[model samples]
Target: MPKVTEAYRRKKQLEIAHAAKKVFETKGYTDTSMNDIMLEANIARGTLYSYFDSIEQVFLEVLAIVDNHSFTFIEEVCNMKFVDQLNTLIYKEVVDLLRQPSLVQARAEYFFSLEDTTFFEQRHKRVIEGITNFLQQGVESGEFAPQKDVRSIAHFMLSFVDGLMLNTSQLGETSNFVYDQLEVFHSSLYYLLGVEN
Candidate 1:
């Protein structure tokens, strides 16, 4: 048998994960099954299991991809002005959620119904830490007021984005009115951060 290189393994795993994401998004976490993913991936059952032990693991991989993508997007915007970072984050989130409501709904289902809360907690913690670090840097640089509680602000921002995404998922395709509301809501957050809008 040919030796499977590490890069090849990772590529196969990502391919399976991408297919699993489509299945989960269409059928949701509860309704999705390993067989469904196998079919979606066009891989045999053994091949699928060789990559992921179970459907939940595949779902987690998909979540990780989404998280990594979001974090990278935020990180890239870190060099921008503080207000620009906040606005860009908010706008990107709304636009992404609107473009991929299925993924957002799958994430909501995972958060609300998954048996293991550890994953959810850890993901949120990392997001909070990232936001806190960014805000702290901004404070040190005099881009933001020093009086704000970085941790609290991070928590609130996460909650705000989650709530907005959850609502947008439930409402299906977002309307202009919803976008308007998000603008107003983001303005309030900007005010809370002492960013002159």
Candidate 2:
């Protein structure tokens, strides 16, 4: 038998997670099962378990993919001009959420519908910390004046995003609505940060 390298293993795991994302998006969390993911991934139960112990674990990995991408973009933007960084943050965080495909929204809604929020709560906390760091950097660089606590501002921004997600998920694929919401969020953030036009 050929030996599997760590890179190969990680690639296979990501493939499984991608398949599970499709299943969860289509069938939803409550309706999706290990069997569904197995069928989607074309893997045996043992093979699936070798990668993920449970469907929730797979879902968490899927969420991590999206969050990681966003965070990476935010990190890049942190090095840009302050106004550009601020605009990109709204674009990535707010507009992107609104523009996500309906199936992706369905997957997000599944997690929101769940009573246990520990998974999402932790993710939200991490996001807040990252946003706080970015805002602090802006304040230190004279892009933003020292005003309210950066942590508090981060929390508020996160709350706005959470509300936008809930609202957009319900609206489905309405581009106009998404743009309108994006404008509102952009304006709100610019004003909150006291950025000059």
Candidate 3:
């Protein structure tokens, strides 16, 4: 009985957090209030408090949700044929931005208001490490071109996706051109990698 009660409470808490996320996205951080979140969640003020200590904490949870989803997609791509895996990873990252990806906006607001975080270091290391290991395998198998500087290429490849997102932000809807650009980037990577044409 107690176990069921706790499970129900947790489910209710996630629902409240999801509602607050929608409100925060539309309202903007400075413009949003705890009352607004409570109203959005359709929960009593005390019920809201039972889930989150503060509005900022709720915002962090939303960003964490976006980060986690993106990483899960990334993990799924990591095991494919080298070229397919790389292309999928790059294409998915761009598609995220093209869809007005949540993490990009959340990150901007966070940096404008908050302190540096260990989350940044750990998440970045995990992403780069996975890509590096896959590329290293391709080189060993003679399936991809051997680069004298595997680490450098890994860094640049990661930067390329980030750079595309940054550029997409500046260009807005006009950035639809990035889909074509990404294809060219992938094709060049394949050719340079000495993968079968």
Candidate 4:
């Protein structure tokens, strides 16, 4: 295939992924059929099959698209020379999650349903490891306050992120964090990390 034609193929695949995301979100993964995606993408059956042989293939790709840069974002930010800077990066990440709300929650829903499968289970484990490593380094460097079990704090931080994502997604409204609400979360986190108020 010509170079230009090959590029178009990649672009078309991404478009298909976006279409699949909408269908999967509206109709739940188990209820979504390949034909639903074909209709949503407005492509012929053969064309859809050319891109993805199975609905699961398309579902996985959609998951990939949604989570494309999140882990990389965390890893790159964690490499900052200062652990404090890394926390700043994490704070921004949490804020972005707050702003979009649904993006992360949708991903979580898809992930839990797929957990029994090796592919999903391995990816989840990898995420936990990546997060744990970052938190461990932060504690060692005094960026985060150490609990006897820093690992629990790390897990809770991730769970907090997940909980907030689910709430925001379920609300499906603008982030409602008021000035007082923001202050409470910030104050609690500061106390947890031993940062001066």
lDDT of each: 0.80, 0.77, 0.70, 0.69
Candidate 4: stretches off by over 4 Å: 1-12, 25-31, 39-42, 75-91, 101-120, 140-142, 172-197
lDDT of 2 by residue, 1-197 (tens): 99899999999999998888788767777688999999999999999999899877888888888778777887776659877887776776566666654345545656668798887778878889888988888888888764477798889887877777767666654833766777887776667777766
Clashes of each: 0, 0, 0, 0
Q: Write the per-residue lDDT of candidate 1 for residues 39-146, one digit (tens) a residue.
A: 999999999999999877899899888778877887787779877787777777657666673676677677789787897888889989988888788778777774
Best by TM-score: 1
Worst 10 residues of 3 by lDDT: 101-110
Q: Give the range of the ten consecutive residues with the poorest summed lDDT in model 4.
A: 172-181
What lDDT tens digits, residue by residue, belong to model 4 across residues 72-125? 776566657445554564467666656642445445556677747788777666
Cα lDDT over the full model 2: 0.77
- On lDDT, the leading prediction is 1
TM per prediction: 0.89, 0.83, 0.71, 0.67
Encode model 3's per-residue lDDT on 104-141: one tens digit a residue.
Answer: 45455655665666766676676688667777888886
Model 3 quality (TM-score)? 0.71
**CA lDDT of 43 in candidate 2?**
92
In candidate 3, which residue ranges exceed 4 Å CA deviation? 1-10, 77-79, 133-142, 146-151, 191-197
Better of 1 and 4 by lDDT: 1
